[model samples]
Target: MYRERAIRLAGAVRWESVSAGDEPVRVLPDGCLDLLWSSGRGLLVAGPDRTAHLSVSAPGERWVGLRLPPGVGPAVFGVPADELRDRRVPLADLWGPTAVAVADRVADGRDVAAVLEEVARGRLVAAGGPDPLGAYLAGRLAAGGPVGAVAAEVGLGARALHRRCLRLFGYGPKTLARILRMRRALALARAGTPLAEVSAAAGYADQAHLTRDVRDLAGVPPGVLLRA
Candidate 1:
């Protein structure tokens, strides 16, 4: 199993990452935008709105991951999930100018983590301090899924949550909840548990509920992952 976490870089930016996985693993649908960047192997991403897939398999055991912000739509990356029917972009292209800087930094014997930190610091002014989006995400993640509990934690009404989420993450609270829940579900599925058990462990209502979620997010049934 791969243990992944959100890293706080030099700036107020963060990226979800995995350290190991010999073969290219596919990231199923999760209702969130993943700005993946690779250091050793190339990553292939594909899928439709709300159901994108990413495949990264390289020879060397190196670092690679996705960078997802709190907001939605393409602020500066590739096309937003809602805009295209199906598309794919290389990890290098996602960062644009930042990628060039990262290359130079890495060329100068800097680690990817250090480069990420530096890039983050350069954009620190763009985002700093406690962000509404970060708060909302933290609340959602801590709740183990997106629940009404987040509304209370953020001190916002239901309508206010929608508005703030729109202003911050692009997608609404419900959308984010689905995405986070799917992420947890995928993690559980990868752990080699039964579909029904994974569903319950991932906070789904039941096996059918988990199946629906897996099908919607991953474009494949839970059985596929189990067999793999």
Candidate 2:
């Protein structure tokens, strides 16, 4: 089973326990980064992805992860978001010996999710909190606001907005908007909405537009992803 919960920290926590017989998990792009710990892989960081990621695991493999909200990862992870884009790296590579200690604690049966949360909370505090403007921009884009309007609202020009997004979200505002729209469409479809309505409501030009975006970001058609 795969489950997720919104916690008091910066974002959501998810846990997945998979069996060898299960099909590969299709993870869609959500414009977020995850700090993940697996039974076999220890601790690793999953970067913001522009496309879907297929995850396969061994028999009885388990995973606990804390997903950081957009604009929060660079601050908490102490790295430029663009540097980690579309990549998964061992935490030790970024955090050094500190990451090793965290892995050891998880190996010793410490609550994996809780440990990740604690680490994130500490980093957030040290970083003097998340970027308020960046978070607001993320929210606006996710709500389907036009990038130009969002930039003007934030008192930043287009070029400045692009730079900020690259530093905070690992992509430009337009790409982030596309990712968010795709997520919105998927949520509506999964909730039993018709594809036509989903496409329109999620800001796509039409069903074909929705299909193309889904294929581009998720590596599959909407029907396949919805069925999965």
For lDDT, the strongest prediction is: 2
Candidate 1 off by > 4 Å: 1-25, 29-49, 54-63, 66-100, 107-109, 130-133, 141-149, 189-193
lDDT of 2 by residue, 50-75 (tens): 99988888878888888888888888
- After aligning candidate 1 to the native by TM-score, how far in Å is the CA of 204 from where it should be? 2.8
lDDT of 2 at 196: 96
TM-score of every candidate: 0.60, 0.95
Task: Give candidate 2's whole-model lDDT.
Answer: 0.87
Per-model RMSD to reference = 5.9, 1.3
Compared with the true structure, all predictions reach lDDT values of: 0.55, 0.87
